[model samples]
Target: MSLVYSTETGRITPEKEQAQRPKGDGIVRIQRETKGRKGKGVCIVTGLDLDDKALKLVAAALKKVCGCGGAVKNGTIEIQGDNRDKIKDYLVKQGHTVKFSGG
Candidate 1:
């Protein structure tokens, strides 16, 4: 169900403003996982501080660098195969603090 706004208050109101989430810290985590795809692998990057458009741009760039496909799902970047080092270096160049997690 959609929210119902009173005619007197209109669409622009303070209630919507309070729902936006604050940007994340500069830290990003790169992890490699392979348990869910019948031996196929993926690198999961989380803790991005940008909005949707920015995140999509970042994902595209990483895909180019890694020479593989990837997607930004639920604010996290999931790249095909293992790319922890490449992603870390790229993020570092972009001025973000990155950390490697998982095997």
Candidate 2:
């Protein structure tokens, strides 16, 4: 049971809480994916336990360091091209435990 409407306020609606991201194991993984983009490789970074804003910031930094364009999707950062080595260096410099996953 909840109050849908109130006389004092027109159409009282409940606040929508932000969904929480699942905690990670403190290890960031960088993997290369090329299945969907017609052989265009995209570096998929995962295992970063960060909120949306922080995740975007990290993605931006990675893109800048790699000198390419990228986007943050589903709590994972996708950097254009195979920039694993560059990303690994940057993440390591940021003090994050980075691992290269898959072939």
Lowest summed lDDT over 10 consecutive residues: which window, candidate 1?
Answer: 12-21
Candidate 1 lDDT for residue 95: 89
Candidate 1 on 58-82: residue-level lDDT in tens? 9999999999999888778999998
TM-score of 1: 0.76
Measured by TM-score, the strongest candidate is 2
Off by over 4 Å in 1: 1-23
Instruction: Give candidate 2 regions above 4 Å deviation.
Output: 1-20
For 13-89, candidate 2 gives per-residue lDDT tens digits of 89998776778899999999999799999999999998889999999999999999999988999999999999999
Q: lDDT for every model?
A: 0.87, 0.95
Question: What lDDT score is found at residue 34 in candidate 1?
Answer: 90
